[model samples]
Structure formats: structure tokens, C-alpha cells
Target: MDLSRPRGSLWREFFLVASLLACGIRQASGQIFITQILGIKGYSTILAVDNVPEDVQEYSWYRGANDSAGNMIISYKLPSTQQPGPMYTGRERVNREGDLVIRPTALNDTGNYTVRVVASNETHRATGWLEVVELGSNPSLSVNATSLVENMDSVAANCHTNATNITWYVNYGPISGSDRMRISPDGKTLVILRIRRSERTLQCAIESFPDIFQRSEVISLTVSYGPDYVLLRSNPYAFNGIMKAEIGSQVEMECVAYSLPALKYHWIHNGSLLNISDATMNLSSLAWEQMGSYRCIVENPVTQLTFYEDIRIQAPRILSVVHREFSILEPTVVLLIVWIVAAGVYLCGVLIHALINRYSNRTNRAT
Candidate 1:
């Protein structure tokens, strides 16, 4: 063997190895940085590293403060070999670019993550923080009673959810407790002590974070109450509890009751049912027989309460007595005129016969 040839071959191999080492050191000096990530539970997330060395050949992932004593999640070398811990059940994987992806993440995945990338001769490292939170589903709203009577019935509203921070709203504004309003300890249930007609809309919402909230379906409240401030009016005239109408004239009377859920009307005339079942009563071609005390009974269907008003209807005052007296005097006046004429004629005939008899007796005595 020639000694010079062996020395040249050894020098050539040493120079090639040193050149490769210098190239790896240059690539390792590149920046290794990652960004903090936020994730929701039951979703997918990626722990991405930025500025990764192009000549990197190995990657290692850890789940703690640093790689010294942290739990190893995944490790990969060069092109194929991969090592995964119990945490990487088929849902987690490391891509060729040194990025870690987790499918269907959970709350336990929140922590500091460290990624170490190795080139042929040097190592590079990066750390990132992951924060996982749970945003629960939307809540549902319910009520004990949809309709309530004012000052008589009460209503309660409940917001059903698993969220911790809950709030109540009425007509798009915050609600506070008072003598007529009450709130539960957990702020889930709201009760109206005396339900009113003004309270119409109610809503419930969950505050997941500051300025981040979700609202449930809106609820419309219905309140029912009285037939108060009842009124009875007629078309022509209504004065001194009387509705005046002339004979053969038409009359219309209306009964008005202020109430919720509407009202049913019943009319009475002279203590007899009028068979009319509506708020308006019509009398076409009125007669003297129709004159009587008319009463309107208004009843609330929801509360089963009743209100009443009374009015007296009379025929025209001038025509009523005139017609009565004219009918009575008509027959009497004709009979009296015939009797007077007959008596006058009989008296005149008797006086003429007496004068004749007296004149004849005087003439016979003078002869």
C-alpha cells in the first residue's frame, strides 16, 4: 500500500464532514418563534411555529414550561420514524413542517408548549401558550303562566342553562327586584308579583366573557284584567240615565268596557232578557212599548268578573200625551155634539106648539 494515497483519502473525508457541519450551524441560527393560540373546547386547534429552519431534520414536542423535564407529546426524526406519548391518541399529529395539530381539543389541552427542531449539527427551540375554554350551548326560557291578570295573578320566568353568569332583561333592558318584581338567588328565575299589562317582553342571556354574550329566545307575556270604567251610550240622546227616542224612530245603543281578552255583553229591559248578545243593541222602528229601563252587563271572560250600567229609554214627551188625549176626546166630542143638537131641536118644537095652543085658546074665548 502507498502511504501518501491513504493520507489524501483521510483528509478528503475530514473536509467533507466539516463542510456539512458548518452548513447545519448556519441554518440553526435562523429564528424559531411561535404565536400564542386560543381554542374552544370540542374543536380543532393548531400549535404553529414560525420561522422554522429549512434544513431541520428532527422535531420534538413537549407539554410544559421547558423541554428539560416536560412531558414529551410527539417526536419525529428525518423522514419517517415517529414516537408519540399516551396524549397523542390518533387525534394529534405533527406535520413535516414541525407544526402540531390537535383534532377535537379539550379543556385539558391548555398549557405551555415547547417545540425543539434539530438540524444536522445544531438545535433550535420555541415556546407557545395555549388557552382552551368552553362556550356552552344557548339556554332556553320558560314561564309558569303565559297570561296573568293584573293585581290578581302572578307569573314566573326561568332561564335554563349550565352557564354560571346569567342575567334577565325586560323589553331589552336590565331588570331589578322591587315590591312587584322578584329575582332568584342564581339570577335565573324572575317573578312578577302583580302582573301588569305594560310588561310585554322578557329575555335571558349568558355572559361568557366581557362583551361576549349569547341570548335565548324571547318570550312575550300576556296579561288579562278587568271590565272597568264601563260606559253605555246611545246615538240620539243619553241624559239623566235615559236614552230618549221618538216613536217609529230607530235607536242604537253601545256598551263599552275597558278590559283585556275582550268582554261579553248581556242586555236587560225592564227586568227581562233582551236576547241580544253583543256590545251594540239596535232597535229599529221603535214603539211606545219599547220604553223601559235598559241595562248593560259587561263580563270579562278571563277573570269571570262583571260590570253593569243602567239607562232608561222613553218615547217622545210631546207625542206621547197628545196621542193618548186625542184618541180619548175624539169619540167623546162627536157624541156630545149630536146630543146637543137633538136637545135643541126638541126644545124649539115644544115652544112653538105651546105658542100655537095659547093663541088658539085666546081666539076662541074672544069669539
Candidate 2:
């Protein structure tokens, strides 16, 4: 064998490696397409690799311990399309067609996955990361009794949700193993049994899968009682009209109080509470006896309030009439004044006639 021929072949191999490196750099600078993704919990999301180079014929996925940085891990190839390699369990494969899908994923089942595509006897790899998030459902709360009956012995409250394997709580107090709290066999409803008056407060909460799902609005209750009712009245005030009675006539000035518990009624005369046990209080109807302020007060000890009305009484004017027998009964001083006027008129006429006659006689004598 010639030493020069071996050297020449070695140089050619070096040149080939350099050229491949340049080609790989140019290819990497070009745009690659990622059309789909998976590892989603609820909605249908698929991992799709689009516009893959025509030269690539086989593809596989792999996983590994976290990279130097704990932030990421890796996935790689497999021996066959049906059988993945050691670290590539639960991975997907892509053939001439470029597509991958993961169904019903778990949160921990997430990491960086590396795709190795083989074409033209060369290998090309790309890495992508997956994040598996757990999505949960909402909850509903209901009181066992539609209408809350106050002062009742005990009651039941229940909470329900659509998700499975639920945990319940009330005001942050866990319901698990609680004597008054119980979960339905199906995990749909949570019942709080034998609720006490002190425990009348209720807060229904739920946890779905990994997180606290929701909390219900608070409900409060209190004891009940009967109606507290009372009636009110005031005293009578100063009067505008006159009151009349005969000399020996009896007059009764009265005040009336009306209320239940039959109010503590008092008769007030000039601001003083008169001790009258009865509903009606009486006073003398005479001007001096009944003239001052009068009031009827009605009060309730439970209510602690007093009502008053002012009243005044006045005596009627009295006039005397004297009568005489015979002729028009000399209408008294009025009749006497009339008679004196008539007598004066008659005397004036007589005097006038006498003066006129004397004047006439003198005229006759003079003539």
C-alpha cells in the first residue's frame, strides 16, 4: 500500500465533513414549521409537525434526565415504531407523515421531547417542551330546606359538583371525617347533617383534582319572635267653647286613655300626674275647679314613652230675669226709660202751648 494514497483519502474525508457542517448551518438558518401540540387535559389538542423536509423518511422521540439546567429534560428514539427505547416510554412516533399525539395526559407526564428525523443517511434532531395543566369544574350549593325555618332544631345543607373525587370544606374547616359532614358515594353531593343553631353559618367549598375549585356564598340565620305592638293617646287641651250648668247641676270633666296592657293611664292637671287607676278620670265642672290644664297620659313600660294633651274648661255666663204681673209687665228699666221719654214729650208740649197762649193774649191786649 502507498502512503500517499492513504493521505489523499484522509484529506478528502476532512473536506466532506467540513462541507456537511456548512450545509447543516445553512439548513438550521431556514424556517421550520410546528403545526400542532398535545399534553392538554380538557380540549382536543394534538401535536402536529408540518412541512417536514421531503428527504426525511423515519422519525422518533426520546426523553432523558434534566439538562445541565434543571429547568428542562429530554426525550429521544426507539428500536421500532411500536416499541420505544428505554427513556422514551409513552412517546409518539412520526413516519413519512409528520404527526404526534398524546391522549389523556397527566401533569407529571410533562418534559422536553426530542425529535430525531433520519434522511439521506444523516440524522437531524429538534427539541420541544410540554406543559400539562389540570383544568377543573365549578360547584353548586343548596340548602336541604328551601325555606329556612327559624329556631328549628336541626337542618341539612348540601353541595354538589360535576367532577370526580371531590373534597369538601366549610369556612376553611375540612369536611373529611367530620361527624356532621359526609360525601355521597358518587362524589357528586356533600351533605352537612344535623346542623345546629350555633353552626347555622354555612360555607360550601370544593376541591377538584389538585386545586380548590370554588366557594359558595355565605348564608346566615337567626331566631324568631312575635310582634311587639302598642297603642298611643294624648291629653285634651284648652277649650274654645263654653260649658253651661244649673246652680245645683253636677258637671263631670273627664279624660279617657286607651291601650293594650291597658296602659298605665294618668290624669294630668296643670302638669301633675293624678292617681287614677281607672281609664276615665273626672273633675268638678265649675270654672274654678275645672279651669286649669287637664291631660290624659298613656304610657307603656316596655316602650318607655309618654303622650299628653292639654285641656281647659270654662263656666257658662249666668243672667237673672225678674217678672211683674199686669200690662206688658213694665218691661223693667227699658220700659221705664220709654215711659219717662213719653212724659217729658207731653210736658214740653203743654209748656209750648201755654207760652203760645200767653203771647197770643199779650198781642190781643196790645191790639
Candidate 3:
């Protein structure tokens, strides 16, 4: 890298970047493209160059279209060395690759910036524009209509901003022109011919630089949809398509559906509407009367769509646990009683045999 800029080199460098300082100039020897970029107020940004010759010895930067060497901001030697020029401000620096970096940029930074490169004996230079802007007002979004029904309603959304780099987002992601969506020429407005529930979150931002967003407040719209696919759920759920609960046990049946504006639930037993109106139906101490096809009707008031689902419930016969327990205990009790009786009989036989033995002995002794 050409790290040093001697006072004698100022006269030579003055003529290097001297021209009309137009954006992206092509020299007679080779081509050097200085990319145009944006700079935010009080922030850092880069003025990059492309197609630089590999045999570069030094890089020099100048401010504006000035032809005099006094406009030189800074210079960088071939590698990492830097020399602050006469016009050097504390905010400017040149990287090893010959790019100009400015930090905490000001409004005055907006203008044509020029860079000169010296490779071997050839001199190449180019200029580009840099527009510095303050982070402006947060974009405001307004829609003509909301709470619309899916596929049946359309809305016009407008983003209020003076920034030319308008970008639109749906559900926090970038969106482009589609069959159902259209954007105005200036990107200040968007129109959706048909709205869907999944496209409810709408937003806009200024992306003057790629991946950098000055975002606006999000707009959440409601698109009322169907009361679709009536669903049945239960506590102590159904077995083999039949909800079987022992008598005196409770069974809870719940109705569910996908709906907007909430769903109203009503229950039916054996084709007759029951008094129950909520999503839950509890059969406490289940009786035979509670046994039958329980139909749940789900309704969406806004969409006027209704769906129904059914769950079959049955109460098994009451279990006689006490009798069953006694049945299990009877055989065990009988076996125990037989064991005691046999033990007593064996004790009697042994006592009688001992008495007979003693009598016989006494008779023999008397003899």
C-alpha cells in the first residue's frame, strides 16, 4: 500500500482525480467503477469501488468536484498505511482494499465523492454520488376497510412517507406483486383485490440500504373466515366411536370449530335440541337418559357459516363392586374353613390314640 503522501505527490495527485467528477467514469486506459451508495445521518457508510487493478500502489480520495489538491480528504498506501490529507476530517478513513469509510456522517457528506488509484504507472479514478438523509418520520399505514370477509372484500392500504425507498411487508416478510396484490408506481400505496386471513399483518418500511429497515408501525387487519369443520372433543373421550362411561361417572363433551368473530355452540341429543348452549356439555352421574348421539352445532355470526358434528355416548350398567368382591372372597374363605376343620379332626384322633395307649398300659400293669 502507498502509505505516505509527500508534499511533492500532491501536485501529481491533484491531476489524478481531476475531471468533471461524474458518476461512474470510464478512463481511456482501464475501467474503474465507483458504486453510488447512501449514507444515513450520524451513521457510518462505505463508498465502494469495483474493478480495481491488482498492481495498486496507493489510493487517494477527494471531496466533491474540486480540481485543486486542497480537496483531498485522505490517502492510503498500498497496504494498511494511511495519510490524512489537507481536507481530512476525523470521520474519514480508507480501508486496505481502497474503500472510503465515513463514520457519524453528516448532511454535508452528501455529494459526489471521488477516488483515485495508482497501479504501476497507470492512474485510474472515478466518482459517485452519496446522499445522506436523516431517519425520517415513522411511516404511517391506513387502510380503507377492515374486518372484511375472506375472498369477498378488498382494501386499499397507503403508506405515508416521503422516503422513496418504500418497501411493503406481510406477516413481517417482504412481499411483491402478486395476482391479488398491486403496488403503486411510487410504492406509497398497495391494493389487495381479495383479502385472506393469513395476510392480516401489513407493514411498510424504508430500506434505503439493503437489510437496514426504518420500520413503521404495524397494521393488523381482520379477515373474517369460515366456521369450518365442526369438531368434537371430550374428557373421558370416546372409545371405538362410542363414549362409554360407567354409571355414576361424569363425562364432558366439548364442541370446537375454526371460526372468526367467535363461534356459538349448541348441543343436540337424539335429534332434539338440548338446553345447553356453550361448547361444553357435562353429564354428571351419567344416566341412561344421557346416552345417545350428541350433535354439536357451531356457528359464526359474522360469516353466517354453520357446521355440526356428532359424538355418540353410552352409559354402561352400574357395577356391583361389593358383590364382585364377596364372590372373590367366598372361595378363599371356604378353603380356610376346610383347613381349620381338618386340623381339629387330626388333633382329636391323636388324643384318642394316646388315651387308648395309656389304658392298655395300666391294664397290663394290673395283671
Per residue, candidate 2 scores C-alpha lDDT tens digits across 247-329 of 33345544344332345667776667677855555443344554555565656443354565555444556788999776545
Give lDDT per model, in order: 0.78, 0.48, 0.79
Give the higher-lDDT candidate: 1 or 3.
3
Give the runs in model 3 whose Cα sits over 4 Å from its true position.
1-45, 48-92, 110-140, 159-169, 172-179, 182-189, 203-217, 235-242, 268-278, 316-367
TM-score of 3: 0.55
* Rank by lDDT (best first): 3, 1, 2
Weakest lDDT window of 10 consecutive positions for candidate 2? 225-234
Against the hidden true structure, what lDDT does model 3 obtain? 0.79
TM-score of 1: 0.52
Clash pairs, model 3 backbone: 1-77, 1-78, 1-79, 2-77, 2-78, 3-77
* Alpha-carbon TM-score of each model against the true structure: 0.52, 0.26, 0.55
Candidate 3 residue 101 Cα shift, in angstroms, is 2.1
